[model samples]
Target chain A: MSTAVDTSAAVPLPAEGDGTPLKKRLRRAERRRNLLFGALILPLALVVLVAFIWPIGSLLTIGVDNPEIHDNLPRTLAVLEDWNGSAPPDEAAFRALADELAAAKGSPAIAAIAKRLNRENAGYRSLVMKTARKLPLDAAVPAREALVAIDAQWGELATWQAIHRAGGALTPFYLLAAIDRAIDADGDIVAAPEDERIYVDVLLRTFWMSLIVTVCCLALGFPVAYLMASLSTRHSNMLMIFVLLPFWTSVLVRVAAWIVLLQNEGLVNRLLMWLGLTDSPLQLLFNRFGVYVAMVHILLPFMVLPLYSVMKGISPVYMRAALSLGCPPFRSFWKIYFPQTLPGIGAGGLLVFIMCMGYYITPALLGGPKEQMLSYFIAFYTNQTINWGMAAALSAVLLAATLLLYMVYARYLGPTRVKYMKAR
Target chain B: MLQPYASPVERAWYFGMRGLVGLILAFLFLPILVIVPLSFNADSFLMYPMSGFSLRWYEEFATSPAWRQALMNSLIVSPLATLLAMVLGTLASIGLVRADFPGKALLTAVLISPMVVPVVVIGVAMYIFFAPLGLTGSYTGLVLAHAILGVPFVVTTVTATLQGFDFNLVRAASSLGANPVTTFFRVTLPMVAPGIISGGLFAFATSFDEVVVTLFLASPEQATLPRQMFAGIRENISPTIAAVATILIVLSTLMLMTLEWLRRRAERMRGARR
Candidate 1:
């Protein structure tokens, strides 16, 4: 570096005739500054790429990733390629299946195949496991007869269709299943059975719950935000602490607080019973009501923060002008005041709605089995069930929704508005 | 304040609005207030009407190995993650402010994506990506994941501070006898110190309160305080969790107070300069 600087100085001294030496040095310094800037950003850029972007991209690919069957049962997959789904697998396919299963014995690959196939059909796991156990690779009997004798499912065309569908290097199984739709026997997308149609309802429930929470926040937050905006700075700052206190509180602690207050014999019920509002202790926790109460409580600050900022900016002269012109107070408020606050409404409503959609801990603690949202299932698949494909598919849906909302926010309300809201 | 030219109905509406706002504020603050007393309940149950006041729950939290380990892990992780976030985020913010390069918006968006993207998605993705490299359940993986999450806060705070900063001071220092590093330390660092410290506080809070990524990434040994609270709440509603929650509430209150103080200091410094 010192040698380069010295050389540059040497060359620039001679080039003083063509340009000023100071100009040349300044140009070199600017170039070096840009290079330093790039160098400074490189570590963070690489970290985001490796730790944030790449993982999310790869996780989204899990929906279409069907390497389990494709990589495991290669011989069977190849042989079954020629055999159409119209009939049971031919003898050659059976022999290929037997070879692959025998080869995959005492290995994790067979279990992978079984798990993949079982996702398509319930009994396919036992069928494959049983068939592999009964028929050895070196069995003298014909492959078709041995497999059919070992399990009747081997003779069914649906079983072959499922295996064929699961055979490809990439499949839409998980993405379809995530929305409670699936490829049927004829390889057509169809709605899953009533019992199997869970994810769609859960997704809808997630949206519905978020919408309710957003509306609740708006209804409850608007007046408070207005009050804060209208109050003296000293009084407003005192009130702002109340709002920011909960905002800064740990989410788990807040959820725990709700549980302590809303349980059967908890404070809320006790108060209600004492006030003669109810004869019996109300069931509040682990229900939809509990979920709503806790979610709205947790999310109200989010709504109020943006609304307060926007309200603080709104001028009172417009309302006074409308009132002087004999417009009713309510009408002036509805027409002049509310229209200007739409940006804040849009910002806070979208922010809260998107946040509510991705909420896991609050809903999981307060909501019951039927009240759980898409995030709950995402966690369930990732942790408890270890179903990466479904987890990824659900996460993709959530990411798409969040990004879409973010884009809308960026386009209309501006990203800085959201940033300021967060920082405040 | 209401206008003097008002009807009786308008007066009624003003009082009603005040009442409603008061109720909403109560709704926001009540739940947080309720937990402080419950944490000292002598009985294990978290119901209303405490059997007796006792420090047993706090004692349990202090004595129990699980709780202590979670607290220790959180202390270790939050500070390291905060430091990493401060360095990377501050550097990136400086580069962003100084250089007018193409795709700068895209780079900024990518840096902030961890903050906006659903935590569940990030957790699942990080788990899958790290699992193959055997990074899951390890402190290195958790810290890296957390540092990524912490970057956006640091970037935002520092950038906000930089918006009011004068870059000519940097040029003035360089044109004088100072090198870039010395100029940065002597001139720029003092101005941005409040921002850096507040950003670090934000990073610390994020890492401390974070549970979703920790759930997906941390093993039993690496269970963070929030993760432990989540388990305790899920498995059993114990007063120990209430005690932990109380401690966290106090910690966050302190952090929030510090952040507020920093903001005021920054404002005063800016005001003094003006």
Candidate 2:
């Protein structure tokens, strides 16, 4: 390098070999590379746009998308616009609703509209369905009285209020209901009825459970991760297999294992009973304890890996220096060593917490009614109940929480090189 | 980890932490390893004190038509999904790492968002999105959804591998009258093959273990092993599930071993090259 520098100093600078300048040539090369990269990326970008981003981006909107009543009863919504919510709609409005219902009768559209309205008022499903069944009311008889005759709910302002609330193409009914809030007759958000207000509690419970799990994982994982970090590479690699093995194993398998071990007649309870720890088998399965155990066990690796990497990077010099400076071993260890591992703590804790927020099968299989988290309800609404709006709303909440934590992760903890990642 | 000058309390703490770490490591294996012995129990029940060590559950897993179907479906779907993910992910990774652009971080985030997004959300969203396109309840949609989940792993692994890539070699190849395509095929692909394969392995493992998306996107005919196990756990705690879980545990251990070995080999290759 010194010889090259001496020759360059002795000789004058050379001109560009080609017509183009070096900077321009570099710029052109970069631009070509960019074009090639852009072309290469197009396929994956398309796949992500079509299969990943677009679906999730649009699915979140379904939470506030209120199209059922708007599509099925368009004329009714138009007619109900001028009328106040103080009383039932006028004759023309009822006639418009009857006409729309008759037009939508015997099709899935009516059921969808009825489902949407039923969300507004509980019994309105039967009212709308019953009215739709006896549709195309005689033009001779007044449409209002005729509809009231089919179902007394059609005569009430509350039923009309529901249809009016669901009038818009995009309404916050499902989203509001997700947080246990509802729009009332006065167009004001109100607390959902006590009997139906399960979501707010569920959301809080999801976060609370996640927090508990994160703490438990950190506590359990810190020592192991620290030990692994302090160990030689061969020993640490041996220990990592235990973490990686469970991690790669199917979640269903882990949940299944928990069931076998935690049940009354399972190994755990039997051992406890045999050891005289308790006279009876503890109610370990189908409870919060079981859920915590499984979640912590599952997520502990996520905690350990990140912390291990961070801890691995921290030199032992500081601890040694602190010890030599007349400081207590434990105190100096904490004062010197602990602070540096903060980023790892933040990374792993946030990672495990973010993962816990979206947990489904663990809580579903292990925990009973009170233990069900937000994902449980998301699945319930999506599958069993087929309430896409409710499902979408619940999903939006969970997705937001996840993205927020991820942003925090990205911002604070650096790039998200997820666990079981890294070439090593 | 210990110092000779350490105090008595420090010594106790060290030993205590070591013992605690030991227990925690054991805890990690408990749920996974506990089920293995039970899978061999002669009895149908998932209980302690096995009637006798037997292969009845394994036989049941092999013979049962549903289990057979799940195994077949898993074998079929995981590979197809892995292929799709590997192709897209490798190409994307190459582009993403080679090209400099604004918002690359954002783009990377978007690419890998599938890994972070809740599975239930992905399942529902895919259902809603695919239903309109007539993709749901079909093998195509199932494969596509699995591919989406798998893509992030491939992208991440391949990207990381590409970061340490020597671009001078590509320049050298092109200067030697090799076209860009030949340069990529001959020089670039060979170097990054380990990363691509390991990433594909990750994708395969993900697809193999996936149950939530399958629940949403698949028909009964497309039930994967995990899906069947999910049903088994929910309805009845059969020893057959234990058998299935054991096989999966073995498979995962194998994958982990392959990944670790491949990682070492890749490191060695890079080391030798550098």
Candidate 3:
């Protein structure tokens, strides 16, 4: 550190070269600043990478990575590398398959391994298990014949193709499963079973339900948000607490409270019956109506806050000015006030809709089987089935859709997104 | 002239709207209020018109080993997550606000990703990523997972607060022979303390209420309060749950009041400084 200061003393003899010494000193200082800032950024970057980025990246990979076939049978994977879906994998490949399956027979990891291959062909596990025990054959012909002999299931080239394809740690199996498709032997993708085909429909339903909920929130929240914005700061702050109080409570508690309020035998029902509005209690809980009601209730404030904040900055004089110029109150509001607040509307709607799409517990508890969202299936695949590939694939679709929505918003409503995001 | 004090039409409309809003707000608070009274129910079912009032359910919650364990688990995890979030979030917030760099906007989005991503996705991702490392179902894993979820609140609150901070004080400290570390602790940290504390409260609230990630990450021995409640809901909708709910509502309301008070104090202090 002293050397840096001493260098200035040593260089004082030169006149024309004084700028060079100063520039060198300046560069050194800049370097120190850069290093210090770099040091500060490194840990944050690492934490984000380790805790967030890496997990999502792995999730994306987990959707496709079929490590069981590759890692468990390295020898066979090496053999099948050059085979290229042309002929039956040679005797060594069959032997390797048999050896690995036999090794994985009793382990819990087998379920995961079985799940990976099952995507390609229905009931591929029995074929794989049957072939495994009859292996270590003398020649290629006998090995291939034995695989065929195992319930005549392995004779179909598609089963072997999926198994061979799954050798890589990364595969499109999960992503395909997300959309109810899987790669066949000929590399053709097809729809899953009618029962399994419901996932794509669920994905669409999730989108539509979220959209409806977002729209409902905007409609209901607009007036309240306007009142908050139009009022004095103290009144607005008090009202804002009403909006924010729910946010402080547990989402689970709020949802549960809604169940108690909205159930058939609950408060709403009892009140309706007492008022003679209905003869019998309505089927409210564990249905789509309950889902929408609770979701909108829970999400309405998210819609209001951004709109309120943006509206606060907007003056009402424009509307009054327009009204005085012969425009009616309604027209003035539509043409002047509403357009100015479009940014808030877009921001809040996007935020709420995106959030509603990924909701799990609310839908899981309140919604019927038909109303269960895509997130429900993602959890099912990940937790209940141990099917990482399918979970990853579903999440990838979700991520892609979200990113796409963000991009579209940025392109069309750039300033508003920026504003709302900045305010947050 | 027979001038009426109020026109019936106008009077009805005014009262109607105000009454509706009042009803809606009351509706929002109904179950919360109901749970409090129901916690003292002598009968077990969560039906309307309680038979009698008693403290048996509250006693059950207090005496039951499982409920006590769950409350204890929440007590342990929430504070640890909050502290971790406070340190990491405050440090990152300083860097985020102090330095202008390329990709800062992207960095902000990345930092907040945990809040936006589906907890199911996070749960599964953590499960897969940590399973290989044997961190799954461990206290450290749950702590880290909850902290990840909590960090965004800290980041958000602290960042917002820092936006209002005067940077000249830090620069002045630097000019007066204070290095970056000393300047931060001596000048900047004190200024952002309120933000950090409020952020920590939010972090604590987020973790204490968190269930999805905890569901995926925890084993039976480590089940959190929400997880326990979730299981109990599936098993039976007992009055004991109502007791727990009442307790949780009380705790949450206190937390929210504290948060509001802290916010008001912060505003007053800022106004005074100005």
TM-score of each: 0.91, 0.90, 0.86
True contacts kept of 3: 0.23
- Native-referenced Cα lDDT, model 1: 0.85
Q: State the lDDT at A79 in candidate 2.
A: 84
Q: After superposition, how far is residue A412 of candidate 2 from its true place, in Å?
A: 0.6
| Of candidates 3 and 1, the better by DockQ | 1
Q: List the residue pairs that clash in candidate 3.
A: A64-A171, A65-A169, A174-A389
Writing each residue's lDDT as its tens digit, candidate 3 over B233-273 gives 65677888888888888787887788888878888979998
Taken in order, the candidates have interface RMSDs of 4.1, 6.5, 5.3
Worst 10 residues of 2 chain B by lDDT: B173-182
The CA lDDT at A349 in model 3 is 89
- Residue-level lDDT tens digits of model 3 in A1-424: 1122222323444355556686777656555544444355566667778977898898888776767767766777777787768666677776666666666766755665675576556687666555555544445456556666665655666666777777777776667767887666676787766677776788899999999999988887887777667667887787766766666666767776776677677888999999999999999988889999888877877787778878988887887799799996667889999999988898888878877878888888788898888788888988888766777888888877776776565566553323122100
Tens-place lDDT digits, model 2, residues A1-424: 1112222232343356967787776676566556766677889999899888899888988888878988888888888888877898789998998898999999899889887777776777888788888989999999999988998888887788878877888988889889999888778999998998999889999999999999999999899989999899999999988888888888888889888889999889888988999998899978899999999988888899899989999999999899899998779878999999999999999889888888887887899988999988998988888888899999998989889998999889985348353110
Clashing pairs in 2: none
Clashes of 3: 3
TM-score per candidate for chain A alone = 0.86, 0.85, 0.82
lDDT score for candidate 2 against the true structure: 0.85
